[model samples]
Target: MNVPAPAHLLSLATASPSHSMRQDEVLEAATQLFDGRFPQFERMAPVFKHAGVLTRQLAMPVEWYLQPRTWPERSAVYDEVALDLFCEAARRALDEAGLTGAEIDVIVTVSSTGLSTPSLQARAIARMGFRPDAAGIPVFGLGCAGGATGLGLAARLATAQPGCRVLLVCVELCSVAFRMEDFSKVDIISTAIFGDGAAACVLSTGADGFAAVAGYAEHTWPDTLDIMGWRVRPDGLAVVLARALPPFVRKEIRLAMERMLASQGLTVEDVDRFICHPGGMKVIEAIEGAFGLGQGALDRERDVLADHGNMSSPTVLFALDRIRQAGLPRRSVVTAMGPGFTTSTVTLAA
Candidate 1:
């Protein structure tokens, strides 16, 4: 059987909003907001300090999250901030690829934190100036798995078109979901780790590039819709982070990962490197457990979590970008778990 040619990744890049907050800063802000309001906040306050995060990037300043925000206001902020990060990341990726927006034939944007009508691709036209006939694909609700899934989708598109340049952008303003009205453990935890950022990559069937897309696969668990996602509220979106998540990852992720790898006709032994979304410190630990790696084995994953917190969908790409910068191994597997209780997996090679 003749194997198909692999799509090549020309370049990868990441971006973050300007408002950087230290973990102590976030902790103090959370204390000010939740100290007297929520009875259990004081007891749960340590979650912020122990989140394995040193700093995070937010589109808005910390004080903005202290006040109540209506859905309309949040939606507007999402549009402005998300588009800015998208353009920045996309430009860097294009530049690193030694190409331009006019050279891009397809654009795939993925996000779940907020909605954008006419999509970010259309909104980015004034800044990017792409060809009029360029394809635009805006995917929503993939949540944290979006980066890996977008990479896979762009690679497949590149494979199909052969010479067409495909740009994949994953942008998420996860900080917008911060809700002051709600004070549950889930709310507190979300405040402790969630941040805003974007990641982008340029791909095509080009012989000269950093890495080639080896394969892609994913598996969504059954009856697991509530595992992790956003819950719409009167004011804005809220987090639906189940307390069972870490345990679930430890219990089930390995078998599912094995199954997905099998779909690509590979095994754990075949992968030389692993890139996973840094959902939080605990989730990173859980991912380590699932893969049978030692603590701190996935240092890039930990570094992204510490520096940027969890930017959801773009997070895995942040980690992948770090790996690419440090230097890639012979083979690598990038994956993330999100709303589908899904594991989006993509393989890359030098």
Candidate 2:
């Protein structure tokens, strides 16, 4: 059987905010803010150490999150920082692909941390210099799976259009959602593992590129809406993380991978490497376990987690960038899980 060629990945690039916070520094700050306020502060504080994050980029200084912030203030910061990060990442990707923003035929913007009336792509159209005719698609609520899902959608669009180019940009300013008043365990863990970052990639039907998108598939588990999502609040979005996440990954991810691969008549052994969303230390470990991979098999995932924390939708793209930099393997699988309890997977061929 012969397989048709899929969209080529022309370029990928990632950008982080200027301000950064070390894990220990954030731990101390969190302690100062949560102690005496939340009764379980001391017990939940250990999540900072166990999260496997050494440092993470922030849209603002660490002290900024310590203060009370209203929805308007947080939204303002999200608007400014998300735009800057998106433009920076998109510029780098376009430059690397040797193409201008005006050449893009389609733009897919993925985000979940904050709300924007015009959407990020719509707001940055003029700033990015994209053509007036280019189609803009803004995807939200996918959370961590947005990067892979957005890339898959972009590839599909480029494949359908043949000569057209598609740009996929994912930006998340998870830091802006920090809530001091709601000192739940989910909030504590989220504070320990969330950061601000952006990533962009170019895809086209042209053959000149590092890798081709072989296939893309997704699966949304039934009745799992509460597994992970945002709780709308007057102040800002509150993190809703269930403790069953790691165990869920361990039990369900491999089966999801199998089904996705089967759709293309491929299997786990056919993939030379796996680049996945590094949601956290436990999530990575669970993924490794599911795939029967040895411990620490996902070094790039760990490296990104240590350097940038979980930038929600952009984290998988950061791992993808690292994989490409290290020289892409002949066959690779990119996967990420998000709020829909959805698992998005993309198969790549070098």
* Residue-level lDDT tens digits of model 1 in 90-197: 999999999999999999999999988979999998799888999999999999899888899999999998788999999999888888785689989988888899
Q: Model 1: how large is the Cα RMSD against the reference?
A: 1.0
Minimum summed lDDT over a 10-residue window in model 1 is located at 174-183
TM-score of predicted model 2? Answer: 0.98
RMSD of each: 1.0, 1.4
lDDT score of residue 15 within candidate 1: 93
Score each candidate by Cα lDDT: 0.91, 0.92
Looking at model 2, the pairs that clash are none
* lDDT for 30 (candidate 1): 86
- TM-scores of all predicted structures: 0.98, 0.98
Model 1 lDDT vs. the true structure? 0.91
Model 2, residue 141: distance off in Å is 0.6
- Among the numbered candidates, top lDDT falls to 2
